[model samples]
Target: MRASEDAGLRDRRRELLTGARGRVLEIGAGTGLNLPLYPEQGIVELVFTEPEEPMARRLDERAHARSPVPRVVRAPAEDLPFDDDSFDTVVSTLVLCTVGDQDAALREARRVLKDDGRLLFLEHVRADDAAGARRQDRWHRPWRAIGHGCNCNRATVPAIEKAGFRLEHVERGTVPKAPKIVRPLAVGVAVPA
Candidate 1:
């Protein structure tokens, strides 16, 4: 799934990770797709996490393959093992919509983030157009059942704001060649409020 992303989308991912510094934690690190993009200097540590066992093993293998190998943890976003204000940066890409408790996970992300930390995200969101959003609402339940708990209609930007983070910059766009109902995306960075 990661490999199939358009060149532009892959470039967007790199743009989001290239400037990161200090301790970084990547939630839902499936297959460690973003592992190779972390900047070489300044970053103290990079952590990758995934909930499922099989995905965790794959992430482990991928992590070891990177130049600055990341630490892998088998854990869910709603509950992280780290202490509060522990990390300088937190990253989530295409993972929020599927979390069992989206609010809990967002709150957890804020909790572990340092007071001056930033959260970088790239996620599919509920559409702003009424008809499009309605379609997302209608397909959500069944879509989640078959798509690994990924609902195509989450109001991700609002959820990020509601999580008590102030957006530094955010933009919405569609994934090229993907279904429209699942393509409305939000890419941004937010800092703890």
Candidate 2:
């Protein structure tokens, strides 16, 4: 991921995290890649949820090195253990594609976020053009197998709306250093509708 990070993924993380504040919950925070990009202040607490044990272990190690270490929990996005309206912000970066149940995970994100909280996200979504989208469909199975369950063809924007959020801002772009089939991206902020 360092190659991806260096190739503009890190910049996207920085941009997406710029507005994050108060208590924040990050879903599917694999290995804590976004940890270093969070703002230096404003956030009172940071919590990360990762269901995969190996990634969680690495997240724990990386988190403890920070000045105010983030709390890492072993949980899946679909079954967040947080109370309703528990966080002022919820972040999802390159995660929605791989979740076992994308809608359930998003609903859980909406469930935990305060009514006025933001959902800052950067996710690889289905391509905009027909040819590119068809390519994603064609390669999805192989990509999923190689990417370890990541489905690069998800229609993520509509899913966000369906899960009870309204898009406040969105930018359609591409992921650098990623395969063409998985490069289309949606970076945005949404709030509970």
Candidate 3:
């Protein structure tokens, strides 16, 4: 993953976060990788939710050392603890694929966001072509074990739409330095419908 970041995922993260402002909530913020990439101005508050204790601890450590130190919450994406309409922006990068329930997590994100809030996401999804998808299916079991529960074949964009978000923009692409089976990517911004 770090190799992927060094290859191009870092730039993707920067792109996903551009223009983000006001109160922000980032679900599944693994190790605060996006912390330094956030714009230097306009963000009133930044909070991160990570379900894993080890990752949350690292995230908290990294957050405290940053300029706009963010608050770290130990909570699952499927069950965020924030109040409704509290955030201006909600972000999910490389996270939706691992959530136990993608639709539930997206619903939670939508619930916490303000009426005009935006969801910025970058996730590896099921491939568009049948051959590629078959490859994903064939490799998925071992990959899931190696990835610690990350699913390589989830239809995440549709799940987001099913959760009541209207996609405002989307760019189909590939994950840098990742295996082809898990490289199919979608980066997008969605607003509450």
Candidate 4:
């Protein structure tokens, strides 16, 4: 990734996570990159849900190394092991693109979130432009094969809406200098209905 692209992702991630507070659950907590971006003052606790064993181990290590250790759970997004409305906030960064069943995962997210709880996400999604979308469709097959099940052309916004959450805010833009086929990043907050 280019420096600009990395910075863009970091900025978008931070923006989505800035005010995250109360009991928080992060799905697909890969390597715990969002651990540091979490706000120190408002956040009451951090819980991470990761299914991959290797990535879970890394997330555990990272959490232990951080100032505030986060609770880590070994689980998939669609099958989260949490009580109903357990978290005040649910977060997913660069995650929905890879879930085997994105709709199920989003529904689970809403299921675990409080009625007024917020869902914050920073995701690389399918492009809105016709030409760019065409390219994304063309590259998705090979991309999924090599990128570990990640889809390059998911309509994340509509999917989130279909999962029963109301979109409150959304910001769509490119990850600077990244490949056009997978460049549209959606950063936003949604509320459970």
Poorly placed runs, candidate 3 (over 4 Å): none
Q: What are the root-mean-square deviations of the candidates from the true structure over C-alphas?
A: 1.3, 0.8, 0.9, 1.3
Candidate rank order under TM-score: 2, 3, 4, 1
lDDT of 2 at 5: 81
Model 2 lDDT tens row, 1-193 = 6777888889988988989999999999999989999998899999999999999999999999997989999999999999999999999999999999999999999999999999999999999899999999999999999999999899999999999999999999989888898889899999999
List candidate 4 stretches off by more than 4 Å.
1-5
Off by over 4 Å in 2: none
Better of 1 and 4 by lDDT: 4
Worst 10 contiguous positions by lDDT, candidate 4: 1-10
Q: How close is candidate 4 to the true structure, as a TM-score?
A: 0.96
Q: Indicate whether candidate 1 or candidate 2 has the larger lDDT.
A: 2
Which model scores highest in lDDT?
Answer: 2
Clash tally, candidates in order? 0, 0, 0, 0
Alpha-carbon lDDT of model 1:
0.88
Q: What would the per-residue lDDT of candidate 4 be over residues 15-39, giving only the tens digit for each residue?
A: 7799598999999998888888898
What is the TM-score of candidate 1?
A: 0.95
Clashes by residue pair, model 3: none
Q: Which residue pairs come into collision in candidate 1?
A: none
Tens digit of per-residue lDDT, candidate 1, span 1-193: 4443763778778888975789999999888778877778878999887999998999899888876778999899999999999999999999998898899999999999999999999898999999999999998888888787888998989998999899999988876666777888888999998
Error of 4 at 98 (Å): 0.4
Candidate 3 positional error at 64, Å? 0.6
lDDT of all predictions, in order shown?
A: 0.88, 0.95, 0.93, 0.90
- Which 10 successive residues of model 2 have the least lDDT summed? 1-10
Q: Rate residue 27 of model 3 by lDDT.
A: 97
Tell me model 3's lDDT, rounded to 2 decimals. Answer: 0.93
lDDT of 3 at 111: 98
